[model samples]
Target: MSLMSDIIAKAKARRMRIALPEGSDERTLRAARILTDGQIAEIILLGQPDKLNAQAKTLGFTLDGIEIVEPVTSAAYETYVDEYVQLRQHKGMTRKEALEVMKDTVFFAAMMVRNGIAHGAVSGAANTTAHVMRAGIQCVGVAEGFKTVSSFFMMILPEFRGEHHVPYFFADAALVPNPDASQLADIAIATADNWKALVGTDPNVAMLSFSTKGSATHPDVDKVIEATQLIHARRPDLNVDGELQFDAAVIPSIGERKSPGSPVAGHANVLIFPDLDAGNIAYKITQRFGKAEAIGPFVQGLNRSFNDLSRGCSTEDIVNTVAVAAVISQAQA
Candidate 1:
């Protein structure tokens, strides 16, 4: 069976709760309907019930199995405001300011996930990446062991025969512009864990750079080498190697010739770019020119599951993202 097929099937069995804040968008409503009808999740739609119902009817969507919540009118509104004020008080947030921020759908949904009203939340369909990310970072926060939040693009590549699987992962493509050695190591660890959780494979991580095993010399190459050493020191059990070129990371023959005797060379499924510039450009180029499916920018290192969608995403994109989030929520639980 397909990877997505297996994930969706597992999600249906788990019956995870996923809150979606963009209730007025047709794509979101359509995805909620699909998830509800498929019994894939317990769908909570965040918006005014009457407005959502009207939007659904106009779009010919049935929300019979969905729960609609308007943050302004819900019973949890006051409690959520109080909680937010406390959570952000050290940053000088007043009750009034907190209340105002809570009215934003993304913040409201984040509060829901924080308070355990939902297993996870998905947004970014009707909002900017910054807004969605800020809400998740502030409210739900990163998992305990991680220092900061990061992202990964789950790249479903074209069929290639060999030892590795069809899908792969690329890290820090949408967050952490220029990570230091520590952050880079954490990003590798987090991406590796996420790949194992979502893709169900023991990740062989390739810390990518412009050089291959000291073949070239640059500060940039040194950074990757240092980060690779950090990962090895911190997570010796993880299968990872670094300072490798793209070809050396993915091409078996080239990898063998370039970085001989390394376990992760050529067989790597997780590629960690040295910086956000390289990571972002690589994933986009692969997505557009290489005809690969980039299913993320999935927010990693978070304590709870929360995913962002592309602003131009279709209804099917929303559905697939929600399904993936549901699976992650189950794993976190």
Candidate 2:
């Protein structure tokens, strides 16, 4: 089965908890309703209860088995406040302000996951990337071994006339603006882990650049080469190669010609760009012009599971992301 099918099957069997801070957007509401009715998991929506109820009724929707936790009533508030105070103790945060910040739906939702009230979180359809991550850092923080947060795009490409519909993974597009060698190493590690879980395949990561190997003499190309070596040194077990042009990374003939003896040369599933500008543009071009469907900008490396959504995402995006979150929660469990 495909990744989506696998996640859906897991959703049917496990009672995953998903926290949506933006609450009642049409896509979120629709996704939550579908999950609840289909026995996918328990969805905890963040916001005022009466407002959510009214909106649901107006849209001819039913809350039914879904759980709604308003900011005031959430058990996570206390937990978040404590964590926030600790994380920001050096930054001079009062307990009262910490409590107030916890009331913010995103913070509260992250706290829910931090305190085990929810399994994972999905937000950013109604908030900025930094704000969503801030809620996560100040509350749940980064994953055990991960030092910083990284992001990826779980892009889905549809088949067309004998073409294959394989999903591609691109990383650090929505976070880590310009990663240094160390940050690049972290990105490679995180992307490798996520690929194993979501795509069920070992990622042969390509550290993409405009030049392949030492064929070109540019500082930018040299940077990619350095990052690749750093990543390899840090994670010797990971199958990764760098200083590769796009064609060399994906095309077997070109890859073989460029890097004669590399495991990740010809077939790379996870593509890591050197900087955000290149990463973001490459993915967008593929998503729009290349006829690929983009699913994430999913935040990784957090202590707990917290995902973000584009404001313009569809109901299907919400559903897929929630499923991704479910997988993450299960993996963390």
Candidate 3:
């Protein structure tokens, strides 16, 4: 099955609790309605209950059976506050100072997930990327053994001329602008983990550069090679290889000729670029010129589930991101 189909299957098999912070937005309201009514999961919308309901009515969105929580007035507020205090105790801040920092809607939403009130938290469509990451790191506290929060873009390409191409996911475009070898290794591992969860396939990770098995030479290409080795050292069980060009990564013939014995050669489902410039450009080209429908810029590796928007996001973008967040929440659960 295709990756997206596999994702849909996984989501259907398990109902994941997705906490939508800033639930008053039109897109969030619509997603909440769809998720709840479609039996996707329990969507806990974080905001004032009355305001959410009133906005739902105004937007003509039905939010049947979707849970609503206002951290300010929730019966569980004290629990969240206490957790926040504990997490921030090392900062030399008093309880009041900590409370002030955690007052942001995203922070509270993440607290809900951290404390097991929800499975995962989704924000950043209405907030900045840095803010969402900070809240997640402080609250959910990264997955076991994951030191950094990396991210990726999942592209659902459109069917063209009666043939549908497989969905492709690319990594670390929106967050880390220029990743070093170690950071690239983190990106590879995180992307692999996300691929396993969202796509339910043991992903073959390919570290891509302009060079292919020493066929070309560049400092950046060396970085990809080093990153590939680091990822192997860290996660030997993962199928990965690098210092390959894009064609070598995906085309069996080229890959065989270039990197004959590499595990991910010509079979990589997850492509990790050497830097942000390549990742951002490749996905956009695939979307705009290649006519692919892009799903994310889904932020991964955070302590909790928090995604970012392009600041140019549409309603469909919002819907897909929420679905991605739901998948992540389910996987972690």
Number of clashes recorded per candidate: 0, 3, 1
Model 2 spans > 4 angstroms off: 159-163
lDDT of 3 by residue, 1-333 (tens): 765556656666787777888787777788778777766667888888888888899887656688888777777677777878887779865777766765677888888878787777777668877787888887888777666677788876666325476766799777788999888999999999888888777999889988888888878888988998898888999998888788888888888988898888887889998888888889889889988877777877776676666556666666666667778877676
Model 1 C-alpha lDDT per residue in residues 71-134, reported as the tens digit of each score: 9999999999999999998999999898899898899999999888999998988999889888
Which of the predicted structures, 1 or 2, would earn the higher lDDT when compared with the native? 1
Q: Give candidate 2's total backbone clashes.
A: 3
Residue 286 lDDT in candidate 1: 91
Tell me which residue pairs clash in candidate 1: none
Off by over 4 Å in 1: 162-165
Better by TM-score, candidate 3 or 2: 2
RMSD of 1: 1.6
Q: What is the C-alpha lDDT of each candidate?
A: 0.90, 0.82, 0.79
Q: Give the TM-score of candidate 2.
A: 0.92
lDDT of 2 by residue, 41-65 (tens): 7898888888888888888988877
TM-score of 3: 0.91
TM-score of each: 0.95, 0.92, 0.91
